[model samples]
Target: MLILTHTLHLNRPSGKVPIEIRLYQPLPTGASWICNFEIDWPEVRLARHGVGEDALQALVIALQVIGAQIYTSPYHEDGSLRAYDREDGYGFPVPSNLRDLLIGVDKMSF
Candidate 1:
């Protein structure tokens, strides 16, 4: 089992804020891998589960779901929140190691 914890910064026009997200395979409470998320905006706190052959695969699935939600968020549609784009000058940089890990995974379903 592997545990990954990362802080996502939402670069909203108002300012940047951090959201805490964690993924753990074979969750401490159950048999499945779980993604736990907390966001200050709209005050959301929830967890979701995914299935995969290994911890990294499971982590990718969880990330896909989380990312989907982010895309669908109001922030995305309004252009208030933007991802790391060099020209746009928005969003924060993801840690190097984490960026490499995410880049290694091909986009997949949850």
Candidate 2:
């Protein structure tokens, strides 16, 4: 089942590229939940999973992982980004500003 779908408009020197991020329902694995996600890029697609304590946590972790990938990847002169198929251990850290842009502010309060 699909949980959430978000579109991010990445600005490049050439123009803006719309990237679609989709989060799917997490499945239980032992004591953790594994969330599956897909990032639809211009010419390539990325499919990965994240493990967390619960469904929401799993989805958040998946997004964080994807954000890290985007932050670490090299950009072309035109400002277009590249994504690798394999994972890089302890990838580059995502800045707060980028995180806010990607995940947005949490409006919910206790």
| Per-residue accuracy of model 2 over 1-110 as CA lDDT, tens digit each | 99877665555778767777787888999999999988786778989988899977886777677666565445322335423223222222243555432321221110
TM-score of each: 0.50, 0.58
What lDDT does the true structure give each of the candidates? 0.48, 0.61
C-alpha lDDT of residue 70 in model 1: 53
Best by TM-score: 2
Please provide the root mean square deviation of candidate 2 (C-alpha atoms, Å). Answer: 8.9
The reply for model 1, stretches above 4 Å from the true place, is 11-14, 26-41, 83-110
lDDT score of residue 58 within candidate 2: 80
Highest-lDDT candidate = 2
> What would the per-residue lDDT of candidate 1 be over residues 1-110, giving only the tens digit for each residue?
43666555666557786656565654433455444433344467656665555555555666665555554567655655433434331222232333322211121211
- Please give me the total number of clashing residue pairs in predicted model 1: 0
Candidate 2, residue 29: how far the Cα is off, in Å: 2.2
Runs in model 2 deviating more than 4 A are: 10-15, 75-110
